[model samples]
Target chain A: MPEITYREAIRHALAEELERDENVVVIGEEVAEYDGAYKVTEGLWKRFGDKRIVDTPISEAAFIGMGVGASMLGLRPVMELMFWSFATVAWDQIINNAGFVRYMSGGLINCPIVIRGPANGGTGVGATHSHTPENMLANIPGLKVVCPATAYDAKGLLKTAIRDNDPVMFLESTLLYGNLGEVPTEEYLIPLGVADVKREGTDITLIAHGGAVLTALKAAELLAAEHDISAEVVDLRSIRPLDEETILKSVRKTHRAVLIEENKPFCGVGAQISSMLMQKAFDDLDAPVLRISAIDAPAIYSPHLEAKQLPRPTDVIAKVLSIC
Target chain B: MPLLMDTAVTTPNFDTAPINQSLTSEDKLRFLRDMMRIRRFEQGALQQYSQGKIGGFLHVYIGQESVAVGTVSLMGANDHVITAYRDHGHALAVGMNMNECMAELLGKATGCSKGKGGSMHFFAPDKNYWGGHGIVGGQTPLGLGLAYGIKYKGLTGAALCFMGDGATNQGAWYESLNLASLWDLPVVYIIENNQYSMGTSLDRSSAFRSCLAERAAGFAIDWDTCNGEDIYEVRAKTQIAIDRAHKQSRPTVLEIDTYRYYGHSVADAKHKVYRSEEEIERYKQNHDPIRLWKARLISEGVLAEGKYDEMDAAAKAEADESIKFAEASPWPSEASISEDVYFEVDRQTIAGRTGKHFFND
Candidate 1:
């Protein structure tokens, strides 16, 4: 076992996949030579060469579509969108081509493509660069959306995504990339649809993912120490194929559910979770599902507004307390 | 093994000889039939749109039939092809069933995209035809990637990426062109310079009004410009481009200067503010490809006037049958509303069970 940062874990996964699969290649702006804007692909170019590690121009639509086309032709293309917000430039290819091509072709084609990038509000990147699009992508049908909180999970899930048949949207938060966790040295893959119950309790179930997962876990610890509330935390690793079983099971046992998300409150991942719970587990619930999310306004450039716009540990704790 | 199968078999590549010397009577007839089929099919699409049987942006490739027919005629089944929104002609020319294409235009479940994608989004992966993309210059890098895959897999296949003069102005086009040339990918970038990017003419929109092949020179790609209206010329030039691409393992650009009879889409009048009626008449009179090919066939005594009439009638009838099939096809069922949305495991079963327990428990 080795203690590694989330960024290093991702870099290791890329290196391993490139080493193992001759068909795997990476294409993105500044991915090669520059070693990625976030350094998640640091030192990959030297290992793989320029052919496998491509440095593309600022052409998101072309490169993303290139990934889709390459995947269709049996190459595993791992593309990086420098920032999550830049994905909008190629939304048509991702939504229409990469997402729907396999089903459109009647299972004749499988797009084994991984579009990985940093997402969410952090470090005052401003409104243009900062966006949490878990809910937006979850609305799409053919994409598998994965958001890992810890270094170990990042490595395992990314490996799974690169090997998966369908396209995977691997969302990483800038804030969590430096956080350390014990990652196994051997090869391992975390399945896409499974959720990990980080901590179990009986009073309330706190559901979160990506950076918010860590916030939820911290909130759970504080709730236990201060309010004597035993809060259960479930990290929804994959947003699209949400581990409904884990969330609902925990909610049923705890009789209270609170969803913590960094996106806007309206139509966020929190809303989808709450709706699913109400529709299926309404009778089992002892309390209504509470959702903690950022305010409705666009993320401001001001550090104070940016901080206020994201869900904090205190926000998750307060929501869990109110519901319980 | 069978007599019928042997007769159906044909050479995989275009002949290296000159077009007239290389093509047999059968080859000429097949090319003529393909061109006629696309022409009639697009004409029917236009009629259907006017009648409101089809909706959305309907871009018909009328005069540019030879480009698709000639270029695709040179390719094999293993080769990959991608193109922009004016894709019906290319799809049909590349051997997609006319009935399925019509069904797609009608947004029927039996369509290529299962009714999810309309005219601007036809896809036939089994045929190695990637799609009909609506976004300009969107498929360039995709085509390059396909070529990369072909080379990476050590397959003797190439990818043909098609775009319009309008799309050439897009930044993605330049990026893909640069990458393709830099990597020496097995790709042929074909520019269908129909002289218009929607309403703007090449002279007005492009800085250089000469051949687009000159633009390819800057990227160090082997380039050629041909008269797109002439099926023979297009076939000859494309063969050279495709051959150079495969042999050299490098990218080539073929600038096919062609024209469009209809407006940009079904909605616009064939002629409006952009070009004068005189210029339209000049193109129609001087460079009518189908008519020129028909005359050449008749002059060569390969086809009689009556036989040409019969081919026209046959094409019209086929187009008619396609429309009927498309009209009679079923719409996608509401039950499949969530289908093809994602490639997720069937968690619905567990979700449903847990959902029921959540309320009851």
Candidate 2:
């Protein structure tokens, strides 16, 4: 087994799927000749040719709809939206058609498509390109939303998403692309709607997803080493079907829960999880659940403001320590 | 021989006749029967809506029956079709049984969409009918993409995407048109220009009200405008467009100038508030295509007047049967609510990360 960066893992998964399945194709603006905006699809066009790895014109609605249509016709199309913020331009196809078609069709049609792109803030990409829309997509009933934290999870989850017989919104982080982890070379898949306990402890349970999961893991290690506080870290890989059993069971053991997310503090995935915990596992708790989230402001272009907006490991550690 | 002489006398110009016209007497009867089936089926739906048996926005395509009938007749079994809310006619024309469509309107378990998708979301995958999308201009880009898929898969089939004249004003329509033309996708974009977009006439909503075909030239694709009232002309134009799209891998837009006799939906009064009653009467008298065709059949001795009566009776009986079936059908069960949300898959286990390094075992 070899260690690979998150970006390389994504590229490897795409390249391998292209090699394994002739029906798999990638389409997006600059995904072909320019090697993708995030370089996750580099060298795909050369190996698969222009037909498989297509560089579409800058028309998100048309290209995304084309991906949906391709999925209906038995083609596994992985379309890139470049930035999650740009997804609004194709919301009609994504929400009304892609998300609803299978349910509306009564299982007659399966939309086996993947809309992959970078989501949330870290770089000073500003308000336009920094908002995390995972909560909005998670609210939709018929869609599966996956946000992987590490390189290994990215490759495995993406491979599973491509093969899954439903439309999936696979969210990646701009900051985590360069982060490295050991990814298996052999074919593998990660089933969605499952949670992974990154680090186990008994003090408090910290639940997070995507980039925030990494921060929680770091904070868990720091808590164990410094204050002898054994904190449990849970990575919620799938957002829609939030793996409530794992979170509830972990909270029952620790009796204290802290949710970490990169989105704004108000009306985020944190709020939904907090409400679910209160309703289902309130009797098992020792302290009220606390949520660590970004400040209620748009991500600014300034580095200082951007840094202040995101949830850091120190913030997660403080939240856990406060609960403990 | 005597047989050849008899055949020559009764050839009926079948070669020169349009695709719909080239059909045998049985096929023509079947087409007319399907049109009547849709008409009667929608009438039942309207009654249901008024009585509260059905809910949601119900858009009926009554007078514009020829567009769906004429165009879908030229499409093969493997071809795909997508359309806007006013879609019952298109659904029935594409071989969806009247009973299933009626059951769908009643929100029953036996509906085409399993009672999940009401009238506006009708889907018959077995017939290759994609959907009855509720959004006005939403299907344009999707239709083009389906066409792209067909071409990408090296299939000879084409996708027939139906939209109204009002949808042409949508930005997605323009973007999809540009992409379809640029890629030379095998798709026939049919504009069911029914003169009004929910009481706003095309003259008021569209700047270029004369014809949508001229506007399509900007996309560098050839377009044609046909008299949607005349099923023959619609059939001919659609045949030409479908042929060009499949053979040349070029997209074509056929703007069919049609009319809606009823209000936009069951909610509004059927009376003409915007247009005059006299204008409606004039269209009914001068351009009633179904009546005109029936008259032509009788005058040319192709079909006896008795045959017309028999077909009408059969159509009425079919409509009555559909209503009975729909009324008796049961609603969907509550247990199956979340069944089709997503395709379920088995879970996978991951190797836990040790505290040693980012990659090493």
Question: Model 1 residue A101 lDDT?
Answer: 69
User: Residue by residue across A204-242, what tens digits does model 1's lDDT show?
Assistant: 899999998988999989998999999999999888666
- The alpha-carbon lDDT assigned to residue B355 of candidate 2 equals 12
- Screening candidate 2 with a backbone cut-off below 3 angstroms (N, C-alpha, C), the clashing residue pairs are none
The per-residue C-alpha lDDT of model 2 at residue B118 equals 91
Q: What are the TM values for chain B, all candidates?
A: 0.89, 0.88
TM-score of chain A of 1: 0.98
Could you tell me the TM-score of chain B in model 1? 0.89
The TM-scores of all predictions, comma-separated, are 0.89, 0.93
Clashes of 2: 0
List model 2 lDDT by residue over B1-361, tens digit each: 1111112223233235557545687666666666777777788778878889888778888878878988888888557899998989999988888888888888998888888989888888788899888888888888997898898998888899999989988888888888889888988899998777888877788876347767889999989877776666778888888888779989998988777778787776744897778867766675655665666556656678787778777777777788789889988999667567765521112211111001011
**Model 2: per-residue Cα lDDT over A29-62, one tens digit each:** 8998999998888888888898999988888888
CAPRI class of candidate 1: acceptable
